[model samples]
Target: MGPTREQFIQYAPAALAVAAAAAGPWSAIAAGAAGAGAWAISVSAPALRSLIACGITATGCGIAAHQVLASGMNPLFALGLAVPAGAAALAHHRNLAGELLPALPATTTAAAGAGQSSQAQVITAYWMEFISGPTQTEGRKLIQAGAVLAHLGLDVGDEHMSFTGIITLPQGQQVRVKPADIASVYGIPASQVEMGDPKHYAPNALPVTVHLRKAPEQPQIAAGIPTTVEELWAAHVAIPDGAMPGTALTLTRYDGPLDWEGIATRERKAIGAVNLQDLAGNLDLSSIQIALAPTDKPSQMGVRVMKEHALMHGTMLSDVVDELAMDSRGYVRLGTYIDANAALVPLAQPGSGARHLYLVGGSRSGKSGILEQILLSAHKSRIAVILASPQAGTIAGAGLAAHCGDGLDEAMGALRLAYAVMLDREARYRTPRFPFTDPLIEFILDEAHMLLLASSQYHLEAKAIVEQLTRRSLKRGIGVVLATQTPLAEDLGNSTVIRSQLLIGGGAVFLRCAKGQGSLVGTNAVEGAEGIDLSMIPPQWPGQYAKIADRDMSGLDTEAAARPEDGTFGLGYLLTPGSQAVQFRSLHLDVAPVSLAGSLPPVAVEDCEAWRHREAIMRTPMVDQRGKNLIGSLADLLTKAEQGPPSAAQQGQPAGPQQAQAHPASSAGSAGGDARELLKPRILELLRSGSSPMTAETIARKLGTSVKHVRPRLSELKGRDEVINENTLWRAA
Candidate 1:
């Protein structure tokens, strides 16, 4: 039961004494005690008890001081007594049930250490929090922590309790907690934690780092850089003491400490032991920019180190660079230095003038599109184009239709004629004594495989002609652009020819084939391996190409810089000489029909009638050589009869009663039973000629016989293997 006022008053003295002991002042204690009693009443009545607590505390202190002076007590002792007494009174007034709690102890602050020792301490703390929090919010906090850790390169070991530490929280506050605690508190798995330093983890712990380390940095490929097989060998031998020639390196921590001798040796070998100066002259490095390493990971070491030297300046280790290169241009461009003394020099324009280019890619892989762009560029240059497509309608309606030819022979002939025409024009105005400029004529063959197919002899001839033209035609300003779906070097006859003419490659097979020959641009020029889809290509972007050549610099660049969304260089751009640059565009041509070698002749009306009458006679069934002879003789008789040898009422043609009544029989002496057989031979003989289809009446007139007699014979002849009547046309089968 609740205590009454009198019962509360009865305990007041005891409460005051306790308060005096705790607070240190008798008067203060008394005041606090009184306030507690009043507070209890106020709990039952409100305003009165609330006012009593304040009044007693103030009044008791003053009264206690006065009592101390009057009673001659120590003032310090009085004040000390009042302190605890006041605290006790307040507690009672507030209706606190338990004993008053003690003041907080001072806490020690220290800096957290690092390494294994600190790790252990942090781990223990992590466990405690992990086991304590088991709600959704805590779990979310854990995930955030893990994310931060990953970003910082930290590897939170597999133990759920391993990430316990003070994490930097929002508003610059630090919360010392375990990852598992945050996970448990937030109700999520530790994996979801997206907080912490990613770099804190060892190299082995990060897949990206591991992959970066394994990836090799390709050597700098420079246009017009003299290099040879011997130099490549020297470069390899000159590799730095600690690194292998082909080992991966990054630019993060590398200084120019490469083994120059080794690198020179390798360079020599790569160029087939050619003279170093000569090799350098043939390697072009224009359009390439060297980038410094951004990170210090071991995986990046190869790229970083190589980037430090002038020799290794163009070498890069990132796939992004390669991707940017390819995506920037519609095709991969390779820079090759031309050697004046080289036999293949004549195949291309002298000193990087204009070069004939061949492009290869598989079906639906943008071969045609790339070719179209190339042709368009040439056209802009005012180069005359001669195009051919055996698949007639396939590329019709495309701007290229003007260049398409009928068949392989016709195509080759057209090219030859164009050449001859150019020659004639050149000869008329320009001789060795007098030079005149003329528009260049470029022959572009789309679907080149049609001309290279094994079944066509014309394909072989075309190949020979193309080879000869490519080898010698550049002097005459004649260029050829041959595009095909196949990249087989043997199919094109000579590997040297393909290498000499190949300017671009797209699609998987074409790239693979090019790579096999070490002809493709480096991986550094392409987007990362994951950037491109392996299965199918996307819709054609007007100028998109796997690689492109820098005509002026004679260097290859992977992709263009222009953004596709703006309709600039959507696919990529090919920079020509001077101020000229062309964006690639795809051709929208219709499918064409296959070309046939010969044409068919037309039929005449007279031939039609003669064939029909002959077929009619042949449809009848008849036998007997003598009867056949009679029918044969009937053809001469009908011709004369038609010419009016005898009139219908003439004496010789008089209708005899017996002649009209009885069927005609052969003089060869077969009676009525065999007589029906006579008509069969004549009809069979006529039908065997496969002349024409005819009715019984027509056959009877041709055979000089009655229709009634010929109809049965024609049926008999049909039953035998003598003839066939199809669509009313009688012919020998």
Candidate 2:
């Protein structure tokens, strides 16, 4: 049941008694149950009950103050009551005024053929539009006096004039005028303006458009027209010298809810394929501001544009190369090349000519990605791949011809086997009439500089073997690709081999690198290809490379790199003999997740038959005739050395596998020590000495052991937390 006056009186006796004591009975009832007080009394809900309680309390206080005043008590009591009552009355009047104001009338959109005189009628008619009742009367007065045009400074122009000022509204709310908002008042498009702190307006005068419209002459009616109309109109038209009055004015509805989705769609299309920075002057943030109410302005908002960079997607290898799409033999698809036309170009034939490839890039620079692509494509082509990496069988372990497991000895062995193959090829080359039949032999080395470092004991031998292979391997259908983080001459023993390999045919694939370092590679490899601006190489463009081919060798003109400059990492340049570098992205196998070297399809026995044929000859068993001959010769030499005085009789004979193998007992002891006991103490010593973390190679060198031997122990130590492996270098835990 709804609350009643009698029920309210029963519940609030004190409030009733106080009110009755100060005023008469009728006055008491009216004061206690009128407006909010009456509404609160009639409601039955808990919230309404609470409001009633507060009203009763306030009423009682008012009654008590009235009684005190009548009794001639201190004036402070009257003042106390007056302050709160006055505030409430003023707030109520303000709210009432806002509610009574009528909204602006909806009108037809202005037509292009609408005469210039119609502009004035449109503006005058717009004066009748009011979002609030209280503002309506004021708007009428302003219009009658012609002060609306004057206040807006109408000049009727193609461009908006701007102004900045703080104005106190009739309701006493101070609003900071925005230049863009002022331009809208004159029916012109606005430029962007910074709306700083809400508390303070900008000091500089803002620019805004002030458009004017000529109206028909009419007799002034006393009730409708004000005395200031002529004066205001005259003041509105006064223009500064040399400033032409703006004509071509268009009226756009100013106060309404914004269409955000439409704005976003339009902007996205306007931006096109250009970068976000390209929209500097063309698009203004204010034009797209979301204003829900008439008073809500762009001055009270902030804007942020989410930008997206050009990230090309992966292209398929088969799609890019015709050979791969067909027979796909003897070609390892690296990546698609981004050609001068910005088209997908494929690298069909790798290791073209004897000049091997040098894949130079920094850590995580998509170097590994490129390597993986090469290996997978090479396998598809039935090319024999020999991998010498720190990790064994990284992408596909079992199908590989050989995996140099994380062992320095194993790595050296792989290279030695390659050298042996080179020797065999040289011998076969002696027969002039031999059939030109042989699978292309690829010696792919990962982290090759470790073996060529000056600190490495076998640097001289390794360098000699690589140089010899680079010079003669191509004719023998052999190719070598060396990938390293550092491809500098110092790291490679000297520039002689690297230079020859690069200049051989297709130049190097230079990934993200320092200007000086990349330039060094270009100049050394491609003649006149110097001063390559590394800045043009996007830092974030992973796997993107600057490839200079034979065509670009003579002249430093790489203007034909590719449009949009950057492409998918697998897309790159392929420089081969007799043709310009083609831009293409590598074809990826249609799998759940494409891997460069890893996750390859199983290698069929038939597919690897060529590799098997070559490997059998290279890996001759020790029990065979060749192995037996070496063993007999080795045994005889050892016996003679033992019988002799054991003086140092080995000057040119560098320490090699054959020499070590001759003395079986000594070799076993040395190998066992290196692989097990000897490396442990050396590692502990290095850590205890407070030396910086060292890589396996550095530790091996210090301990006179192979890197292969130290890595396993390092792994064990790392697991035990006795040592820490930071990016491959080890330190005390």
Candidate 3:
């Protein structure tokens, strides 16, 4: 039975004192005095209080015992004396016969031992759980005790009991199993299970069965969707199973009757019926031949029916009649009709597989804009571009500014460097195993002809670079796109290079250039071929173009559809947009007026003097082939004349009667003449150095020249050098 409230109240003072003494020294003294007073009160009613106080006193003793225990005193000593003494006295007064002793259990000691054992187990379990659960496990545990209890079983009152146990098999081996009625007892619904059997609860279900009942065969799939000869030929002839006549049967299930006229119309449009005649003229019969042949197998006929249907509509039979002539090469027309309104069409097809492109047209002929579009497309594809322009700022904002340089020299240098980098990158991947993966880097040099002309003096070098790029760079994924206003044969270099390119341009020269080179072959080239007069090219239309490819018109149509708005077309493909394009302009060089002034100061002339000295040393003459003193003799004569006399050898050398008579006069005259001639240039140089422009007469007078003699000498100087003839006033030659 639990202690009563009155018993608790009667022992409150002692209980408080015990609790206080456990807390602090000051409280211990106060609580002891209070407890003594309570004990004194109990003495007055000792019998009644002792019974009630015994339980409270036991609780108080436990609390006080804790204080002694915490201070390293033996709590068992205090408990053994106080608890047993009280219980013994109480037992002595009580009737023992046929009665259960109402004494307190030895719970404090038992609890301490049990708690210590349990804490030790908990600590061991914590370490084991940490290591086993988190560190050592390779994968998640399939079953956890806590999860099994929560999910698989009914809750019991026991807090520590897990809803887990082991199952012992007949062999006496134990297998851990969480009791899960849902998983262990019940099976999933039949439909929810995927058992490989035809009959339920059949132990000997056959793995596979073949029923004797007749079954309908599946129909062929070639009955629907469009197909062409190349596809059919590939499926039938090239592949083993593709050509089976039995399998070739087409079973087309339609919702209603077929629209024969509509199919015919589509076939006509796809085959370009109206352009059949044009196509016929352009067809390369030597390369490909087109002819009609009847077959019991209409599907085997493939595109032949489509081609005929197209001819019947609007296309002339002559157009594809030649196409039917070819037998070896496989051809497939992807799509038909030009979609001028489709935005994505242009981006779908790039240039025909040609490396070089030639674009020519007059101003306002859409040459530049067309070139820009092609370049923009190339740029978007991250193709390396090298542009050369004499006109600065022309292609500034076109993503090519950084690659562009000042003039032909710089432009060529940049191109050479770009080529070298590409080569180096390729060479770095030259190992037997590894290979280069870079896409072709195309070079678009607008006004390329200008570079050709500007570097004409360096023609051999220019040609070598261009030729190297053209010949070697193709395999390395390098190509050149050149555009010009003129199709000069010299600029483009013989028709060999021009013909190899995908040509785009309008005008007589362009057509003549293409036609002469045999690049223009089809009816388009022939019909408009005559209208390609360069003189008649209109300024308003800039995107007109002529296309050529090794494939049929279908290929051209596909290519046209593949071009992108911001994309670049190959050479000769003119680009047309609906709006005006803004052009970038660069600053021009300013020329300053020439000044006629006093001669430069001596110090300022140092550089000029050095240049003169270098020039003199370079110009100094060496011994002639005959070992004659070429410049030395001239120098010696000047020295002798400066000293005012001829040496003895000079006087005695010519003493024949006529020579002796002529010697004195000739020697005297020659000395003055040599000196005068030597000083004449200096005198003229000084006269021209003055502020005012000088005439030949003024210059001659200043230099003490005879008028008649000065004019001829001045004429000689003017003829031999660049003399400033400003308003007929002479400066210097």
Clashes of each: 185, 41, 32
Per-residue lDDT of 1-733 in model 3, one digit per residue for the tens?
Answer: 9754334334544445344435433444544554465455543344334434443444455556666767888767655535543553354233221011112122211111133333233322322332212324345343322211111111122111112211212221212332231132112111211122223222222121111111244656666433543334334423333222222222222211110111111211121111212222322111011212212333332111121111111221123222221122212111111111111112112222214455565453335544454444444333445565544555532443225544655555544444443333333332212122443345656665655664454344444445545554444445566666555455554334432333222111131122233232332232222212233222212222222322354444453332221111111212112111111110010111011111321111112221233223222222222223222111222233344433446544734666535434333334565644544475367545654445454554445444455565556666777455543346565
Single out the weakest 10-residue window by summed lDDT for candidate 1: 336-345
The model with the greater lDDT, 2 or 3, is 2
* C-alpha-based local distance difference test score of model 2: 0.43
Between candidates 1 and 2, name the one with more favorable TM-score. Answer: 2
How do the predictions measure up, each by TM-score?
0.31, 0.37, 0.26
Best lDDT goes to which candidate?
2
Question: What digit string (tens of lDDT, one per residue) describes model 1 on residues 298-370?
Answer: 2221121121122211111121122211111223322111110100111124323225665555544445544
User: Better model by TM-score, 2 or 3?
Assistant: 2
Choose 1 or 2, whichever is better by lDDT: 2
Model 3's alpha-carbon lDDT is 0.34
| Candidate 1 wrongly placed segments (more than 4 Å) | 1-354, 393-402, 406-410, 422-436, 493-733
Error of 1 at 76 (Å): 15
